[model samples]
Target: MMPNTYTQIYIQLVFATKGRDSQITNLVREEIEKYICGIFNNKGQKVMAIYANPDHVHIFFSYKNLQITISDLVKVVKTESTNFINEKKLCVNHFTWQQGYGAFSYAKSQKERVVNYILNQETHHEKKSFRDEYVEFLNAFEIEFKDEYLFEFYD
Candidate 1:
């Protein structure tokens, strides 16, 4: 008999527009969010929550311990989503995601909290910029990041 692999992995991913530009305007944020969700769903991943802001995006998803690496998943998502957005001409100019992304894992118990955070991004951003919020996440998780690697956008 074959052995079974059991695991529950939840990830919250954050990535911004190239050059920290605010390209994901209200005009197309929802569509882009849905498109990204579709990508994860197609891979048999369960998307818990997703939010596409003016300058960045937050996605919480369930990863079922697939053969693919996390970096590969993020790369495909960014590449394919950029291609989809550009092909649809969602923006006046070309659009691209930043080269680097922030991915943090969480316990299943914290899923609801993470989902609420992603869902209430609009209100949260009203109080603080995404840059600060992201930095906070890095700090909270004790992940060391160089200044240059971090996304900076003056909103």
Candidate 2:
């Protein structure tokens, strides 16, 4: 008999636009966020919170699918979202996600905190630039990353 398996994984994904342009304006932010959530839901994942900043996005979700790797999930989300945005002409110019993304895992105990952080991205960015915040997250998570390889920071 096959043994039953169970697992819990919560991840917060961070990614920016190709040129780091403030393209995700207020006019299209809500639609884009909802579309992204749909993508996660369709994959059998539960999205706890998501916010699209002018140039970046943060998504917190409970990963339920073991068949797909995190890297593959991120790639699918980015590609589909880009297509959704461009096809809908949500932005004045074409839209595309950057090459890489930051995926930070969190304990179940920290779910509320992560959700709040993602929901408050607008408020949080008022004081801190996306570059500084991303760098801080990398440092806090003890993830080794080269500055050059990080997202392009125009701010």
Candidate 3:
């Protein structure tokens, strides 16, 4: 039997900063998303969707060879976005991503549904806070999560 050929995989990653002040405005958020996309594109990764709120970000990406680990990809996105924001003088204080991130795998058929959910974050947040939303994702994925580690953006 021949070895199985590599297959492309899609992942949805969610991460936020330590504080709510990280995302000051839409301009800053747009820059961060653009920079992340640019970085991944340069490395031959394809970004399927992206959405940013005042505190966190959701990114969906697909890779052919699976060359990048989730940690490596998160690090690059955070580091590059931070540098780009700083270099452009976009924000006053230093920006940083939280210590951990939430990543979930999805079937190819679910791509559109996932992307739509991400794209409508702004509207969705009107009824649900980021914390609640995050919890929902965790629950939907059936992953165990400690409440203490989950950051609350809205009071």
TM-scores, all candidates, are: 0.95, 0.97, 0.88
* Residue-pair clash count for candidate 1: 0
Greater-TM-score candidate between 1 and 2: 2
- The whole-model lDDT of each prediction reads 0.90, 0.93, 0.81
Model 2 earns a TM-score of 0.97
**Tens digit of lDDT per residue, candidate 2, span 56-75?**
99999999987888899889
Best by lDDT: 2
Instruction: Show pairs that collide, candidate 2.
Output: none
Q: Please rank every candidate by lDDT, starting with the best.
A: 2, 1, 3
Model 3: how far is 128 from its true place, Å?
0.6
User: What lDDT would candidate 2 get against the real structure?
Assistant: 0.93
Candidate order (TM-score): 2, 1, 3
Model 1 lDDT per residue over 1-155, tens place: 99998779999999999888889888898999999989898777889999998889999999984877779889989999999999999977799998888999999889999999999999999999887899999999999988777886665
